[model samples]
Target: MEKLKESISSVLPVTGIVFLLCFTISPVPNDLLMGFVLGAVMLILGMGLFTLGTDLAMTPIGNHVGSAVTKSRSVWMIVLVSLLVGVFITMSEPDLQVLAEQVPGIPNMTLILAVAVGVGFFLVVAMLRMLLRIKLSHLLIAVYLFVFLLARFVPREFLSVAFDSGGVTTGPMTVPFIMALGVGVAAIRSDSNAENDSFGLVALCSAGPIIAVLVLGIVYGDVAGTYVPVAMPQIADSKELWLLFLTAFPKYLKEVALALCPILVFFLLFQVTKLHLPKGELIKICVGLVYTYVGLVLFLTGVNVGFMPVGSFIGQLIGGMSHNWIIIPIGMVIGYFLVAAEPAVHVLNRQVYTITAGSIPQKALSTSLSIGVSISVGLAMLRVLTGLPILYLLVPGYLLAGVLTFFSPPLFTAIAFDSGGVASGPMTATFLLPLAMGTCSGVGGNVVVDAFGVVAMVAMTPLITIQLLGIYHKYRFRPEEVQEEEAASEDEDGGDIITF
Candidate 1:
């Protein structure tokens, strides 16, 4: 009941904003409006179920896998398992599928496999970092620096898509599992830094897709991919609307089933071989999996069938206006409220609150993410309006994030990077990306170059704001308390060695 209320609260603001826009400046077609209303309801219900499902099933599965693998004390097994887990989880992410469909010139499977491999490789790197106790800041600096340098060799058209890959890769499907995996891996260590270390797996995993897509760009060499516009559904009556959602159910049901299958098989492998838990617990996890599957199917169906076309139409309508500059402020406002609608966001916020022992309030972190995404959407709109190069914004935004890593507390730095990935979940892909694409179409801009990077911009800004939150957190403490906490962390720095 509490979770349902939270989901309702998260989704209502965005629904209100869309309806308000429809009635006023951007009057959507009646059919589109009707779809949006139905989609919003499904979104709320699906999100509630999904969040509940993750808590019961995904988190426990990740924890079990991480703990069991680490306990084996075999580096080879850990690396191999981590790699496979990353690939399968990423391959199953629905948001990545959404992104792949929008991108032209590349086969969906090719892009999907490429992104999966990248995430798998990076997950290995993240695991190693935990065992080695490497500083998250320094590693992030190097990884991103390498990413940008590689970007120089890729084609301009592919740059935004490549960057956007990073964001979508860490959507609702991946964040909960990955973050819990980090916690499970960190559980072996009894130290102050363990909590801080539990973060940053998502951070590195996010980068993996960027590098992978950029490399794909370089190899493909300026293959021009065009934005494929979504055709609005024609609904003559309420029955058709009902049928529209009803028909989508099978497709998403198949998709969600396939997505969850790999994870389920992986868990069962562990259950039979290692995690011989009580039958009662197994029943609970099975129940949770059912919820996860149903919730995702409903959620994906709503977003893809209902929200997407409406988003594109709204953007097109608004961008075609004489005072098109309004799109910037409007985008900013939508982006602000939209973050709250993301399912993975609630997961991230709750984990951050738990890991930090509630030192960082969920409300504060949520606000920072909102502010960051608001700025990102505004910038994304500016690019659509003026044909600004993505690099003009990305290079500086990342550099600043890199610089801030040095000053912010390590926990904050970790949380900040994780926040970047979490902020740009399904809502960004289904709605905001379409919103940007629609605006670009209306404004006669290069949709591929201008609108494609909205997800990337969404992914980048929270790295700064959350760290700024961290900096604020750093200063909020008294000098003595800060010194004491720092001293305590340092003392446990060399506590033990149990690497696998």
Candidate 2:
């Protein structure tokens, strides 16, 4: 019930905006509106169940596996396990599936394989970094430098998709497990920086897909594919609306099952060999898995079947108007509330709060994320209006973020990068991406060039805002008081290592 209320509060503002737009400025078709409403309901319900299920099942499983692997204390064992886990989890990610399907001129399997391999390689790097105590900022700077250097050689169309992949790859299905794995691995250390070390797994993993897809873009050279608009469903009656969601249910059911299967299989294997436990706990996890399956199936069905069409339709409607510039503010408003609607976001927020012992409040983090995303959305709309090149924004945005890493607290830098991927989860992919594409179509712009970078934009801005939050945190207190807090925190942290 607590989870349900969170989902409701998160989703309600966005839903309200959509309804207002439908009836007022950007009137949607009856069928699309109905579908959007229905999707909102499913989204809220699915999110609630999914969050609860993740707490019960995914977190524990990842925690156990990570702890088991680290306990082995063999570099080879850790590397091999991390590699396999990264590959399987990335391959199974539902957001990656959605991304693959939308990208043209690339075989879905080919793209999936490339992305999985990329994430696998990076996951190993992340593990090694944690073990070696490498500076997250230095590694990020080097990796992003390499990423942009390679970006220069990729085709224009592939550039946006490549960057967007980084964000979506570390989404709802990936964040909980990966983050828990980070916690488990870092728990072995009794050092002061252990908490900070636990965070950059998702940050590094996000980069892997970008590099992989960029390589693919170079190899496949000039495969800038055309965008195909979603066919607006023509629902004549209530029964047809029901049938639309009903039909989508099976496809998502299969997709979510495939997504969850590798994780489940991996967990079961760990349980048999490493994590021997009593029956009661096992039963609870199994129940949680069921909830996860149901929640994901419903969530995907709602968003893809229900939200996608409406988002695109509304975008087209608004973009076709004489004063299409209204999209900027509208986009900003939606983006502000949209991050809260992301299931993975709540997971990240709770984890941060617990790990930091409330030194960094959830409300503050949430507000910063909302502000960052709002600005990013407005920038994205501006890009669509002007057909601006993505590199113009990305290069500077990332450079600024990298520079701030030196000034901001290390923990904030890590958390900010992770938040980038988390902010652009299923909601951004399903709704915002489609909305951008639809607006591009309506405006007669190059859809691939103008609309495809929204996810990347959503991913980039939080790096600035959160680190600014960190800088604020740093100066908010006097040096001695800050020192005292750090000393006190380190002393207390022995008992504060978050356990699943």
**Please, what is the TM-score per model?**
0.97, 0.96
> In lDDT terms, which candidate is top?
1
lDDT of 1 at 15: 90
Q: Scored by CA lDDT, what does every candidate get?
A: 0.90, 0.89
- Across 1-500, the per-residue lDDT of candidate 1 in tens digits comes to 88889999998998999988999999988999999999988998899899999989999998998989988989999999999989998998999999999987788998999999999999999999998898888999999999999999998999999999999999988899889989999999776567679899999999999999999888888865566798899999999999999988998888888788888998899999999989998999999998888889888888998899999999999999999999999999999999998989999988887877787889999999999999999999999999999999999999999999866778888888998998888999999999999999999998888889999999999999988987777776665677566656657673211110
How large is the C-alpha RMSD of every model relative to the true structure?
2.6, 3.1
List, residue by residue over 1-500, the lDDT tens digit for candidate 2. 99899999999999999999988988877888888989999999999999999999988888888888998899999999999989998898888888888887788999899999999999999999998878788899999999999999999989998999999899788899999999989888778678768898999999999999999999988864667788889999999999989988888888888888988898889889988978999999999999888888878888898888988998898889889999999999999999999888998998999888887899999999999999999999999888999999999999999999877777888899999989998899999998998888889998877898899999999999999998888777565666566557546542222111
Candidate 2: residue 309 Cα off by (Å): 0.5
Worst 10 residues of 2 by lDDT: 491-500
Candidate 1 regions with alpha-carbon error over 4 angstroms = 487-500
Relative to the true structure, candidate 2 reaches a TM of 0.96
